[model samples]
Target: MERKVPTGIYGLDELIGGGFRNNSVNMIFGGTGVGKTTFSMQFINYGLNRGEKGIYISMEMTEEQIIRESKQIGWGEIEKHIEKGRLRIIHTHGEDIVILSRFLQDIEEEIGEEEVRLAIDPLTPIIYNVQQKRHRKTISEFFNGLRRFGTSVVTLEEMEGVEMMPLYLADSVIKLQSLGYGERYDRTLRIVKYRGGKHGEGLYPFSIERGLGIVVDVTEEQINRVTPKMKYREYFEDAKRKIRQVEGELREALLNKIEALETSWTRDESPERVLQMFFRTELGREI
Candidate 1:
């Protein structure tokens, strides 16, 4: 079996055969306000929490804007991760293809042999800046460089009639669609392709929550059938209050994780079991 890198988004891993294939380049395309950036950030944050490094290269937003927006969506540890050398964020500001290529080389050198997760938000700037004749070569080289950094998730804006070359180069492709029908199921996710693994078929309903980035509504009926009825929100709140008792950085990290769980806790296991696991992993102690 191929080594899998777990995507931090709740309920997404099980759909893509336990996460993305290790060292593979994945592409996510979506229209505006369709949760593409959130998906990429969640992938990077997931790696950072597990002691893996991450690099976020943004062509649109600045470092300050990214940090502020991330905190607004409940990823409080992004600044802390950067301070501790676990994460690095770069803003290209629509730089040319040459400068972007140089940035990738410098990152590869800095990472050395350590595996790192990479996120490039809206790759349209870099790829579209080049000539049409060079699109194939540029995309091929760019995808190859991303693979060296371990696993990567790159986002692209969904244009009406434009053909995206990255879609063909990527090992996996996930397309996020916004139906705009103003219903509960306005947004949906579809796995367009997974090179070597079987993935869930059909469009899955999803929502972009405040704390939780993108929660894919998969396996809800199965979880409901197996798990007993309980007040998940009440239990999550109690855990949050307890987490507030701790001081300093650990407290902030714990609270962030708990808040995300509060928004998308749909597992078959009880919340108490999940809380215990968090305590043991983060605090190195039993609750």
Candidate 2:
């Protein structure tokens, strides 16, 4: 398997073959309030937390505004990362392609060959600022420049014709939709295209939560893979029986924890390994 740069969005990496391909450009497009900026922030913040350097180039927001929004969403350590020189935020006007090109060149020279994560919130303005006849040349050059910075997550506003160019050019394209149905503000994410990888094909339900950013609901397929062909309850039956030997309130607590695991465990560990660890550590006996 090729090395991947995890997007750091919960439940998203699994859907995109571990994560975005290393050094690839990924596009995230959505309408207003569909959490596009939050998605970009989460990707950069994920790298920053891991001590990996990140650069955020914002055409829509100022440095102060971006920092304030990051803190409001519970990413309070963003300022510290900036102070430590692990992360940088550049605020620029998108319409000036000449100036933006110079900034990108300077960034590339400074970053050199280091593996860094780059985030461009709402790349629409830059693309839209160019003449229609020059879009191909302009977008190609822009995306090529971004690839030099290692892995990148670029956000785009989903206008009727504005997205087709970027969507076609990106290594992987993720579409975020705001499905306004009645009183609910339901949102979904779909993998529009992945150049060289298999990806989830359906609309994945997701929610934007405080501190968590975008939380994707784990599909039944993801949960079921932990125990192939075997139901979780049947796989853990022997472990449950072992828990019966555990007496008092501890017994009930153990059983409840097991029940929770049966429904909520989405990791790659097999049920046998999980149950073995559970019995060995919790009950002090092998099942």
Candidate 3:
């Protein structure tokens, strides 16, 4: 049997075939006012449903604010878990990022002792702090440190223009796109990439309401299919091997042309001119 993890999403599990694998850094990125926080709540809710303890790390929202917003979405049951000592909410303090980095370090020490599933809401504060404070070195080290702890982490990131700052760092990058049509808006989620793991492609719609909590409408596949008309890994590997072969041939052809130019000499041209000619001819363009 294939082991699976729960994503705490509505209709998404069927799309990915299962949840995200254990100990992977899963990132959710989008513009402001998207469902990033709600999605975070859903994951914590999933852990709660499974009777696992969870921790909510907030850099912007107060713990009370989180509870209230959750209640508005009918996830007020979150408080019950807190009451049972199954959930912990940590608010971000001064110099937001330094405080939070210290906070994450502290939590790392506590995870094993507490066995808590953690969710860090809105990664903007962390990125902003690093940029404003010139802590690029520390930020990367911090991310790698957290991954070393081997816990399920979902961090929310905000993207503007075409930047890969945090996206390049995460093991999995999930993009939540928000679209407005007429007077209504919709949110969609897609895995931009999943390192060392498999995921579904394209966008999947999501919705949230007080009574329904959160829901996703996506495609489904036969999870039990034992036979295949095609096997992706084997076929994809073959394609890659062929592409490598073509690239090698092109590279060797270029090298041979360069060597051929070195053997030819023109006595009429100056030394500099001769070298330039060799470069242009061998490169097949202006060098």
Candidate 4:
């Protein structure tokens, strides 16, 4: 079998069975601040590092803005790659078919020389120009043109669970979400589907740090860190098991509190504190 294209995002490659298939289009859907842009940039940079040319087509951000954001996230060498002609970043402000066609033309021409890693950030704007029925046909043809050169990744905005037009067209789909549970937000990444590849299912908690970018934890222990329900349930189970050792009305009261544990409490307060509070109050001692 041919080798797959590495995304360069740690832990993600393993989920999709050793990265993406070459000459394939992968769809990445995420809401605001869910690290879609950063991930795409990282993918391009990774390809560049491996001595492969890359092209980043943006419908929203300028070249200067992309360079600035990439630098902030420790991907400062983007400019250097561009300088060496190993990378190309294009911001297509065009909204119509003709303009989009021209943008595709540039990409086709660039990829003619060598195998390149391509990223189309927020592919929504380009495809949204046409009607819904025409969207599938138009977008499909556009992506088909891209595949003749190299593998590509297209980022899209999640439309509140609505069926996106691009999701059906891409070879692989990666969905990202940021849920505000507890005192702060928890980010998650899930592989929706990877055609002809074995992928891990379910939401895996991920963090977007400054230098690290996006890192996902597939292990049970690491997953428990950001999984509120799982983490709290473990805490509840431990307390429940221990509470059984105590006798009489005190134990009964603790049981009631455990059953009464609300989602808000699990999120706002620490689960360990719930048991500690009961111990301190009933036992007349701090734990």
Candidate 5:
């Protein structure tokens, strides 16, 4: 129960109890404008400032683009880490996996290398890399390789379905959400899931301020919070059970409506009659 990786995002740190457990892959999922990339960068930049070696492999933007933004985000010192061999920013196309695998191999060979932080910004492009042929085995191998690298890691994942793959592999998961539907937008973030650590399910509001960095305000009121090291299986099972009951009730109601509509005894379908028919047919009540 050693608390490590401590994200340093005040409220988030308290909720997740330190930070993401060491040597794990974490999915940070959200829509395009939700600032998933920025959050990932912030996490990586924080690690870099601590002199922890890190590799930020990005498919969406080049190394220079992220570095430039890092400077604008008040992390210009990250460039010094890159020069000191404590950080590496790589941009890859279809062959990113191969390149990253080789890089990991090199780090393995290096004698006396410090613990690394690996951030693969927006893991969505990997789908296109293998042309959707990537299976569970390949994905598990991907995560396994990361853990083998022996570092604290967070992988940004752009997902289609809310149920995504890397979440199953990662020791933690943070989901970034946004305000505004269209052009005008503001960013919000939440920890959607985590394994082997405590994390809150409630949405914690965050903002990227020019002077303050990624500040998380816990609100003046006490918000609902989950236990650190909460039982993952139990929570998920309870959630599934609730959803199943809801679905069954919805289906039953639909069937009853169809049956009532088909009955010749039906007239205007009044509120009272509908209630009466529902009780009589479903609950065995009198006409």
Candidate 6:
């Protein structure tokens, strides 16, 4: 089995096929105020709770600022973790970054730690200020340096109209988007890439709460209310009939997928979600 690590964000791991691959580097990118920093902090806290040491290297925020914000979100134990040396927060000034590759090499040489969870918040500052000719090479080298500490999550600020180099180098990519302003705004997350898992695609709604942190918006109550096994049998037969009604080429494809779905049911996978995906993708309708 591929070793995986939980992201600690509610309802997200299941969508990404059971968290991230261990020892892999993942990148989270978003516009300003889109919760990249909060997500990164939550990831570190989750690992800390799991008895794993964590490191957070911030370019835009001070160690105190990070602790203060973490406290605001009810992560009171953050200070204790720091005091006990379970977590280390590093502040890298966002000064000249012309030689960011060399800078990262120096930082990695300084730490000399292995297999720790690392989060670099706002990697954009350094990469953004680097000279254009060496952009991709520099970004690749920075990621190579991060691997010295094991599985890493790097957060980057999304420039208004510029494509970032780190987005392509990371093992996986998660994008957060909050559109509009104020009460009418909508927040969504997309797993743009997951290197080795059958992850869910497209946008998923999510919200940030005081105690819960990031929670994916799931319509379980309205759409996935559990039914007894006898009722499931009835639905299963009905699904078979519906699949039979599909036209030639699509019918063959649905049959193959439905067989997989049948096996999934035995594993206690969400029948509602499977059926919904069937309807949405195969039939272009909803359950």
Which number leads on lDDT?
Answer: 1
Which regions of candidate 1 deviate over 4 angstroms?
A: 99-101, 160-162, 220-287
lDDT of 5 by residue, 208-237 (tens): 676446677664332334332222334333
- Assess candidate 5 and give its TM-score to the true structure: 0.67
**Ranking of all predicted structures according to TM-score, beginning with the best and ending with the worst:** 2, 1, 6, 4, 3, 5
CA-lDDT, candidates in order: 0.83, 0.82, 0.64, 0.78, 0.62, 0.77
Residue 242 miss distance in model 3 (angstroms): 24
Candidate 4, residues 1-287: lDDT per residue as tens digits? 55789999888876665789998999999898788998899899998988999999888899999999988988888899999999999887537445555667877777676889999998877656654556678778887877877899889988764458778889999999988773223788888888864566767888777876887767754333323354457777777787788888888887777765622242435578667887788777644
TM-score pick, better of 3 and 5: 3
> Model 1, poorest ten-residue lDDT window?
221-230
| Candidate 2 stretches greater than 4 Å from native | 99-103, 160-163, 182-185, 222-287
Model 1, span 1-287: residue lDDT tens: 36899999888887775789999999999998899999999999989988899999898889899999899999999999999999989787544555557767877876788889999998877766664676788778878988988999999899875458889999999999998998867899988988865566668889888888899998756334423335677778788888898889889888888876654454555688878888888878866
Residue 120 lDDT in candidate 3: 78
lDDT string, candidate 2, 1-287, tens digits:
46889999999887766789988899998898889999999999999999999989899899999999999999999999999988888888777665456757877875767889999887887777764667677777778888878999999997686746888889999999987883333788888998765567767788888998999887768534432234455766777887898779999999888876665444455688878888888877876
RMSD after CA superposition, every candidate: 14.5, 12.5, 13.2, 14.9, 13.6, 8.3
After superposition, which runs of candidate 4 have C-alpha atoms over 4 Å from their true positions?
Answer: 94-102, 160-163, 182-185, 220-287
Residue lDDT tens for model 6, 81-190: 98988888989865655676677666565456557788888777776577477678877777777776678888878877555667888989999999965542388888
Evaluation by lDDT, superior candidate among 2 and 3: 2
**Model 6: lDDT of residue 196:** 60
